[model samples]
Target: MHYKEAKHILSASNGMNLYRGCTHGCIYCDSRSTCYQFDHPFEDVEVKVNAPELLEDALCRKRNRCMIGTGSMCDPYLPIEKTELLTRRCLKMINRYDFGVSLLTKSDLVLRDLDLLQSINARSKAVVCTTLTTLGEELSRIVEPNVATTRRRAEMLKTVHEAGVHTGVWLCPILPFLNDTEENLRGLLDYCFDAGVEMIMNFGMGVTLRDGDRQYFYRKLDEHFPGMKERYIRAFGDSYQCASPNSAELMKIFQAECRAHGVRYEPDDCFAWLSEYEDKQVAAQISLF
Candidate 1:
């Protein structure tokens, strides 16, 4: 891990990544795509030492409060986060300033800040987003080796839900010929439904492969699923979006299950919910007045 002083913290849309690289090695991580242009190795996490201070300044200067998002580019709860506590410090600022937050992660370490998340939710909104790609623990280990398994993440979702915080799941990057099966999809959706997640965001039963990430993913495929790399090369042939052949059938089942379970499956609706800032305390104050 290394530290860098970032000049800015929040994006135009109010999203921020406290760290640049990720240690929770998801083999299909889109952030590792060459389009992102990382100067260093993906696991050599680049900690934004000034993230908390910069976020405080940014939030303080904003005329209107909005959701402060994180973990889009890198998982905030990476192993380094346990000691660095940058994400925790930033959350303290967000809570102090009464700003909403939308945090995305694949780690159960997020449970450490349950109290702060609850506090923020009580004031405004605090929605937790977790990714569920593979349901089988062994498959999860092979794919997202360093991060929490899908079952553990589902448990974390339940924990967040019981804390009165809404949760969303990113059911994405489904590898073709690997985990792009109806069984895998159903198993993952069962977890979401059981955990009481408010919404699920799935682009399709497919994963994208690009310059940096494609090479890495193919290398992993070679290592774990022999002859799979050749198959991908033969099938995709430098294509960017590698849609699984089961995409149509799987999406039908996905939508049907979500509807049956009363879970939000529309991507736009889920994103709107995540981005919307609701101040329940403010509403209560106005009611009292």
Candidate 2:
């Protein structure tokens, strides 16, 4: 890990990445794509030492309160966060300013900030999004090695929901030959249903592979799923969108399950919900006058 002073924090859409890389080591991480242009190794996380300060300044200057987002590119609750507390400081800033927050991570360490999330939710809204790629722990270990297992992430979602904070799931980057099966889809969907998630954002039962990300993923495949890299190379041949053969069937089941459970499955709708800000304190704050 290394610390660097950041010139700014929030993006135009009100999103921020407290850190510039990840430690979770998900084999299929798109952030590893050469497009991002990382000067160091992906594992060598770059911490934005001034994230919280910049966030506070940004929030203070905002004319209208909006959701503060993180963990889209790098997990905010990385292992270093246990001691660094950068994510915690940012959450405290969001809560103090009574702004909503929407964060996505594969680490259950998010639970540590439940109090601040709940506080933000009390005045506005806090949306916690978690990813579930495979159902079994063994597969999770092989694919998302350093992160929490699927069951643990499911448990985290349940706990977050029980805390009265809105929760969502990203069931994505489903490795074609590895986890793109009916059983895997059904099992993961059951976990989402059980957790009472408001939405499950799944573009499709497929994965995208580009230069930097493709090479790393293929190497991991050779190490664990022997010969899988060759299979992908033959089937994909430098194609960015690697759609699974079972994508159609899996997507059918996904849509059916979401409809039956009344969960939001549309990507646009889910994105809208994440960006939407609700001010629960407005009424009470107005009453004070």
Candidate 3:
């Protein structure tokens, strides 16, 4: 990883990616898309040296204390974070400002910030969003290699919920023929529900493939699933949305399960929930006064 001084940190939407590229090595990472236009290799992992300072400035200048989001474009708790502590520093800054945090990652390292997350939740909203592709550890290694396994992520979610912080799960990009089965869906859903996630986002039970992302995904398919690349090309030649053949049945089960379990499954509702910020500490202070 290389460090560089950054001019700005937070986006207009209050989201920040402290690192440009990732080392988690997810085979289906959309961040590798050509649209993002990375100057260096995807694993080079550019570090924003001034992320904490810039975040402080941005949060201080904000007229409203909304949710600060991260780990969308890249995993904030990458291996580099063990030494750099940039994600931790930024979380501290977010806590210092009493702003809400809604982070999405596949790493169980998020558990290390339980103290800060609990404090933030005490004062304001602190939502933890983790992406779960499959519950099979072996399959997880093949796809989301280099990151925490599925079971470990579920444990992290349970830990966060026990700490009184809200959590959500991103159930996505179900590789058409590979993990788009009833068994895979049920295992993933069971993990999310068992962990008591506030939301389980399922956008059509499919994956989106664009220029750069599609090429890499197909290559990986060829490497692992042999002839799967040709199958995909035959099924979705040049198409962006690669909805699984089981998407219809699987989505039916998904929606029904979410309804029975009372978990949020609507994408819009989940996004709205993430954007909402509640200052419970201020309310409690007002009550005391």
Candidate 4:
């Protein structure tokens, strides 16, 4: 890990990635795509040393408080976060200023900051989002190695919901032949239902393969699945969007399940919910005054 001073922190949409590149080594990680230029290796994390200060400044100067998002390009609760405390510090700033947060991660390490997250939710909105790719622990280890297993992430969602914070799940990058089965989807959806996830975002039962990420994913496939790389090449050539043969069928089941369980499955609706901010405490205080 290396620290560098960043000129700017938050994006126009109020999202910030405190670290560039990820150590959590998801085999199908899209962040490794060539379109996102990285001067260093994908595993070599780049830390924004001035993220907290910049966030504080940006939040203070904002004309109105809105949701602050993070953990899109990289997981905020990566192992380094425990020591560096960059994510924790940013959450502190968000809590101090009473700004809403929509943080995404696949690590149970987020539980460490439950108090701060609950405080933010008490004052304003705070949504916890995570990705669930496969239900099998062995497959999860091979696909999303170095991160928490799917079961653990589901447990984290339950913990978050119990704390009275909203939770969402990203059911995506479903590796075609590997985890696109109905049984896998059912198992994962069951976890979501039990965890009481408010919403789920899925872009079909498929994965995206671009220049950089494609090559890396193929290499890993060769290493683990053996001959799976050739299968993908034969089926997809160099196509960017590689949809599964069973995408239509799987999506039908996914939508029906989410609807049955009252989980929001529409991407637009989920995103709108994340972007919307509500300050219940402030409203109540004003009402009292």
Error of 1 at 36 (Å): 1.3
> Can you write out model 1's per-residue Cα lDDT over 222-245, one digit (the tens) per residue?
999999999999988999989998
Q: lDDT per residue, candidate 2, 1-289, as tens digits?
A: 8999999999999999999888888999999999999999888999899989999999999999999899899998999999999999999999998899999999999999999999999999999999999987898899999998899999999999999999999999899999999999999999999999999999988999999999999999999999999999999999999999998999999999999999999999999999999998777788899
Q: Report lDDT (Cα) of residue 195, candidate 3.
A: 94
Model 4 poorest 10 in a row by lDDT = 196-205
Q: Please provide TM-scores, in order, for all candidate models, with all chains considered together.
A: 0.98, 0.97, 0.98, 0.98
What are the clashing pairs of model 1? none
Across residues 1-289, which tens digit of lDDT does each residue of candidate 3 receive?
8989999999888899999999888888899999999999999999999999999999899998899999889889888888899999999999999999999998988999999999999899999989999777898899888988889999999999989999999998798888999999999999999899999987887789998988898888888889999998899899889899888899999999999999999999989999999989779989998
TM-score of 1: 0.98
Task: Quantify all predictions' global Cα lDDT against the true fold.
Answer: 0.92, 0.94, 0.91, 0.94
> What's the true lDDT of residue 192 in model 1?
94
Weakest lDDT window of 10 consecutive positions for candidate 2: 278-287
lDDT of candidate 4 over 92-149, digit per residue (tens): 9999999999999999999999999999999999999999999999999999999998
Candidate 4: count the clashes: 0
* RMSD per model, one decimal: 1.0, 1.5, 1.1, 1.1
Task: State the lDDT at 215 in candidate 2.
Answer: 94
